[model samples]
Target: MKFSYKAIDDVGTVVAGTLEAENREAVYLALAERGLLPTEVASGESFLRGYLQRLELALERIRPVDLIFFTKQFRTLFKAGIAVVEALRILEFQTQNGKLKRVVAQMGEEISAGGSLGDAFASHPSVFSPLYISMIRAGEASGSLAGVLERLVYIMDHEHRIKARINSAMQYPKIVVGALVAAFLFLLSFVVPAFASIFAGANLTLPLPTRMAMALHAILLQWWMVSLPLILLLLAGVYWYQQTPAGRLRRDRLFLALPIMGPVFCKAAMSRFASIFAILQMSGIGVLDSMRIISDSIGNSAISHEFDKIGDKLREGRGISDPLRSAKYFTPMVINMVAVGEESGRLEEMLQDISDHYDDEVEYEVGRMTELLGPLLIVALAAVVGFFALAIFMPMWDMVQTVG
Candidate 1:
């Protein structure tokens, strides 16, 4: 349940914000924890308004760059001794994204209402991730919100650059594959049909490749009405399945097992895990809590599940490195470095090293994938063009010989 509450803070300024709680008592307790005196608490939102908010959130997408800029500017402002609410108000005005601006304004209002910074961020889960909220909560508790935002800006910027590099490497292959499909479709739809009609007029035996090409052309021309819907249904089913838990697990596993791209993804996930874990630890978050938070931050479900197991073992009083040895995705080097970090009392430094190591590895693997895939794509393209050429010209050569 959500409640809108009016409160008076230490200086007796009135503040108001919405909070999720089981009852008014919970709301009162939460406000008290924040050192606020609650005057009034009202429960629930109108169904239509709630529906509109949900729709708005679904439509509003916040990009990484937006978050990076927000955090960087926020850290600079807060470090300059501006009050949190004042800094947020500045951001609310300075933000370029209309949706982000609204979110910033709402956050400022929440803070003005005597809500904690973490709570304000939590209210917008689409804009703030679990890792972000947890770190902010830790920062609030430690009185290091500005520092935390600095680290967040760094992490978000690094992640964006990594993704950018990977996407740049993939752009060529994507364009090549798309072109191949377009050319093949055009050949089947127009060129092949014309040649197929000519072969039909000749009434001569066609080679197997020619026959296969002509059959594909026939399907494109005659069966498209039936085929289009089935193709769409198959794609939709695939998307739905991938969204399911078991299907996501299998799909992520398959991603890690892929030949050229697997190591890039694996290294990227490891880099993210180490980076987030290090920052969370540095921010005064406990090891177990960091593990739980990092698990959700990792993009791969298979790796995330392993982190869950590691968290379970941490609950059993085992150290982080020991259980990591048993995880399939944790490289031997990572396990050894973690073990050393545990013994040396330099876990944060070690985690940073691990993150840096994997960051380099991800870069190298992406470059290697580009190199390997370039030749492979060329070979595949050659084979496709050669096959189509043979399929079309073989019949022409045969006709020429017959006429001679």
Candidate 2:
């Protein structure tokens, strides 16, 4: 546990700080050992604990892999007949990440102090998500926490795979763009200037393209003086805009509505929703609650808003397929499958199929798009370079012919 402490030293100097320790008594003893008299020692169970809890909660938002590993390890240990508190204690020592280690230690202490596994995880809500907590609660209620942990691992692994594919798909384009930008800067700053110097002394009347190239080169040289502030202002504007809910919504909508990427984005979002819903269903969470949790997990405001309406419809006892069909973001085929699932009482199975199907579709589309982008970008670069070369040399060719 962590505590905030204020202590007076032997020479009457006061010191205040926070530290992680075993308990309040241990904290006081440690201070006394340092020749300090504790004037005020705030326990980890106080307001400071609440603050740490909030920080832990935020960290949890980004640590899906960590959660998966923890769950998987805990389950493995549990199945081997290791006690829960003992397993957590071993995990605390085994973890290399300081924050995770600290968290595991805290959990171990909590459980050892008679807190239930779910309650221990609940205390660090930042690390364990609603889906995680819900599934654990179900497992506890059903007396199958080990099984639930295994399922959680599978779900997390699936999510990781999807994220990896997206990253892989984007990597080529990112590299291409980065290379293009570097090459452009090199030419404008060095190559173009060298050519410009040579042409300057040639006393030739340059052609239109050559003149345009020279103008561009000059502007680039001068641009930083104007461009720097403009860029900073643009960044500031973007930051300010994103800070506003409306602005963020508008930005998200724009991203989803992009011509080439909209379909891919929508498919990815749908895939996530389907996969999360399937996991929730399998974990014994109800349909409406599952939808709400899945919506929160999707991470897009526009899609989440539509999901909210779907939840409302579900609350009114309408079929899941009805609101999903009305949303129009999902394809007709998807809606049909969902309808079939609803009718067959196998929504989880159908959702898993949907997730698998779209994941493949997304992967294929991303690969195709990446393959198409490479040649298109290369052609554009060649055209720009060719135009500049022809423009500049044409004047030189005319000059050489006259001299000959």
Candidate 3:
């Protein structure tokens, strides 16, 4: 069932949203989870609409920049010796993202109720990652929460920049490809059909290219109703499957095996692992715990799953470098650095160096990819345009010659 509720936020402002649950009790629980106090609750008018709204709310994500800003502010406040609850309260007011503000409010409530900072953060696993929680816990135990937060800000900000760079670099290609697809569809559905009618009335012998185009237009007209929904369903199914564990592993593996972009992605993942691992170590987290945290937080499931085995090997009395050497996802340079760092008791420094190296490599590769893909897309666009033009005009030329 669906329930619509008007709830008061942390600041006593009445906010309204929909929730899917069994009863009023469930609605209350759900609202409480979002740091809201229910003032009025009623059954929703439409079950389907409410369900969709609830799903949309569930999928709403807090942006990385918001997270970085939050962490930076908290770090500054905490460094000045502010109390945890007070800092969280300040953040709740300062934060712009509605969901993040509510999360901050809940964290403040938890802290005020005598919960540990790590526990408060752990309660919202969807917002804060395991690595973040682990580092927070380590910081609290060591009374260095400010430093931990500072490192977190750096990590989050750096990751955000890398992602932004990749996205910006690919924007042109995405636009071009989308336009090409749109043009193809429009011509096939509208232009080709009109031309097909003209050719039919002329009763002229059509060239092979014209025949092929007509055949495609015929198939499109006949099966569009069925094909459109089937294609959408197929895409949705593939997306859903990609979210599963096994399917994610296959997806990541495929991502890393792509020709040009694979190296860029692989380097970026390595950079992330190195940087996070170094920070965790410098934060005084144990190696095994750090490995586990990294495994859980790493974006690529295939690499994370492989990295998880290192912890098992560590438990069996193996060193970090030894296990990493067996992990195929890691490059030889990374393995060697790990070995050297382990030998010299400078693993943190070594990991930081690896991160820096990969960061440069990823940037360079992304630039090169942009250069390569521009020409490739232009050539592809020209080929498609040429094919369509030839298909439409070849028979027109034949008819003109016959008349002459």
Candidate 4:
């Protein structure tokens, strides 16, 4: 349940805002812990307001870059000795991103209404991840909000650059595949038909490749109405299957087991896990909490499920390295590196090093993938076009020789 409450702070200032909790008692305890005296607490606003707010949040095009800028600005303002409320007000008015501006305004309102900074951020779960909220909560408790937000800004910016690098590497292959498909379709629809008609006039024994090519074109032309829908239906079925839990697990597992791309993805996932783990730990969050938060952030269900297993063992009081070793997703080097970190009492620093190392690995693998896949894609395209050209022209040359 969410509650709207009016409370008095230690300074005799009144504040009121909304927050979610399991029950009213939970809400009261949360406020009381923050040194606020609740005067009135009630269930949150009308369903219509909730619906409109959700609609706005859904339509918001807020990006990671936006959040990075928000965090950096908030940190700078807070560090400059500006009051939290005043800093938030400045942020609310000045942010160029309309979505983030509104979110900042909402935070300002929550601050004015006596909501704790952590809970205020938590309320906008879509814009702020659990990791982000948890770190903020830690910072609030430790009186290090500015440092925490600065660290978050770094993590968010690093993640964006990593994704950009991976996407950049993939662009060439996408263009090549699109061009290949378009060229094949053009030949089948335009160029192949003319040769096919000429062949029909000759009525002679065509070479095997020519016959096969013409036969394929015939099948496509004759049953295109059926084939097109069937192709779409197959694609749709695969998409639906991949969405299911079991199907998703199996499919993602297959992705990690693939030849070239698999290693790249695995490295990226490991880097992400280490990066989040490091940043959260550096922000003074507990190891178990960091793992739980990282499991949600990694975006790979199979790898995430493995992290869940590690969390379960952490609850059992086992060290991180043991559970990680048992998981297939963790490379032996990672397990050893984690074990070293645990022994050294500088696990956060160690994890940050590991993350940096894998970021380089991801960069190297992406470069290698682009270098290898680009030439392979071009050669494959050439071979296909060559086959089509030879198939059609062979018959033409034979016919000309006979007439001569």
Candidate 5:
């Protein structure tokens, strides 16, 4: 077979070329003999064509549930003493997701060709994060791949739960906002104009609020040509700002400073940091390295920036708790727990405890927000709608009273 290969030469320059080989193993050995580290090898034009075809097939077959099921199934199979290669082959055949099947097949082939499981996964960094890869590498070194996979499944499950909670919390607010927007547009575009015609025909002097509403209706009806474009442009500007790193950082910082929601955001960040740090430490990664990885995965640039400072302090031989306490983003309780963990040499356990504690705090805060927001939003919406209704209707009511 002909293979396309990527390798780094002795002098560290990356080279890509095609070579004839029996399989990927042959290509890897051929490169290794020449003091090149083979990064990847795929068989010929046929492989590339087939891979693309299979990718589409896989996307149609895979769902979030399917991915979750596969993770669980793989964990089960591995625990049942199945060989990693065989387990992957079984998963490949069983997976409905075309992409997942192809990935499983590639992983199986790579493992069979003497590549480490982590190395096989490293080929798909988008699907598998550096944290995942690091854990797997640590597991392999400690001869505990199965244990690592189990922990990974647990971590992913927890992450998914958090996502579900956030989605659920946002759903009602989004619906309410959308409904209010539609109602406002309907009033301005149709209802208010009907009232305006009545007042005009009756030749009555409208109240100040009623006159203002009629004027707004007229502007909306007549100048939408200008207004619509302006609205779109403003939206575009906001989107562009959010897409930039500085803008995102500014927005996240703003979110963390919000009155009711700011504490929730901070708690969420702290929970994530605690959880990921705990997992990395449990996986046998060093403190400094784990902190770096955890910081990268925290997802908020502001929080991540703070973590960079923490990592720097650790590198300079400062205690973890001291740096974190100095940062002032973390709560005193969290700092104290970390200090205890560091002193007792059980930082991982302490981090896990902190994560568990904060996870509850986040959930409670979200629930409180939901309870408070529902009534607040309803009252606010009612007030706005009532104001518009009174503004338009009071004039017509007075005109009727005068005629009667």
Candidate 6:
């Protein structure tokens, strides 16, 4: 049966939402399953009409930085001895994003109604990651939600720093490459045509490069209608391909194999895994569960596949280090560190150390990529311009020398 329900939040605030169930008792069980206490449940098609309306909230995406802020704010509020419901209410009222505010209020209602905070957050997977939900569950089970929040805040802030650094490094090269392509196209399409006409009027014997450039300019000027549509179609096809599962897998494979940048992504993925694994371990989650979470946290299917293999090996009773060593992407140093951690029963600490080390490695690689790409782009730009100049100016120089 479909039911329209009214529930109370963690902060004693009333929340009205809808649910699908077998009966009124099932509705209550479902609510309780989510850590909610239903204040009112009404059956029939009356509530189902509003289901679509409730389904479409503000639709705002929750950003990483916003999540970090939320975690820190919650930690502070919880540490101050404020109840979860009240804390959520305050955040819901104060939050700038309409979507997040509504979500926070919904979670507050669920939690207040006796639902777990983790389950409430889990309901909105688009806004909350599996790692975030898992950590919350671990914290709730261990009765150390505040401590988990603190660690989550730290991990998020650390991730933010690393991401910002990589983005900053990548942004400059992207801009340079884009600019180069634009200038090259502009020169070839417009500027070359004008020069070609001048050379044609003079009836000068053009060099092979100038002849080829003029020929290309002629084709662009005459048949751009066909070329433009063809180009657009090709680009659209490529984009559509990229959006497909097979295409995404191929793209990621190429990205991971790319020189300089590939290693950085690999290191960053491993670092995220280690960071999450450490948090899960410290929060008292088991090794098997921790490894499962690590797969989702990494964000790369190639790496996730390797983790899945490792997971299967563990399920077969093999230890962590041995399974991990088989992953081609795992550096020898990381494998050694995990082996050491296993021996000392300090795997969490070792994982944390590995995370920190990779963070440094990612930073160093970003800097190196920047240093290497700058000169390479400059040389490329110079080469292209030099070629155009030789093509356009070579005939002129020959004529002037002949006149002298």
Best by TM-score: 3
Worst 10 residues of 4 by lDDT: 42-51
- Order of all candidates by TM-score, from best down to worst? 3, 1, 6, 4, 5, 2
What TM-score do all the candidates reach, one by one?
0.85, 0.80, 0.86, 0.82, 0.81, 0.82
Error of 2 at 318 (Å): 1.2
Mind sharing the TM-score for model 5?
0.81
Candidate 6 stretches greater than 4 Å from native: 1-60, 402-404
Rank candidates by lDDT, best first.
3, 1, 4, 6, 5, 2
TM-score of 4: 0.82
Backbone clashes in model 1: 1
Per-residue lDDT for 37-68 in model 1, tens only? Answer: 99977776664466587788768778888898
lDDT of 5 by residue, 132-177 (tens): 7788888888988788888888777777676677668777777877
lDDT against the true structure, each candidate: 0.88, 0.81, 0.89, 0.88, 0.83, 0.85
Q: How far is 78's C-alpha from truth in model 4 (Å)?
A: 1.8
Q: Per-residue CA lDDT of candidate 2, range 178-247, in tens? A: 7777776676677677778877887878888878878888887788789878999999999999878788
With a 3 Å backbone cut-off (N, CA, C), the pairs that clash in candidate 3 are none
lDDT of 6 by residue, 308-348 (tens): 88988999998889998888699999899999999999999
List where candidate 2 sits over 4 angstroms from the true fold: 1-8, 15-64
Q: What is the lDDT of residue 125 in candidate 5?
A: 75
Point to the candidate with the largest lDDT.
3
lDDT of 4 by residue, 1-404 (tens): 78888899999999988879988899899999999999988776664476687887768798888888888888999999999999999998879877888888999899899999998999899989888899999999999888888888888888888888889999999999999988888887788888888988987679887987888899989999999999999999999999998888888889889888888889999999988998887888887888889988887888988988899999999998999989877988889998999998978888888899999999999999999999999998997798899889899988988788
On TM-score, the stronger of 2 and 6 is 6
- Candidate 1 vs candidate 6: the TM-score winner is 1
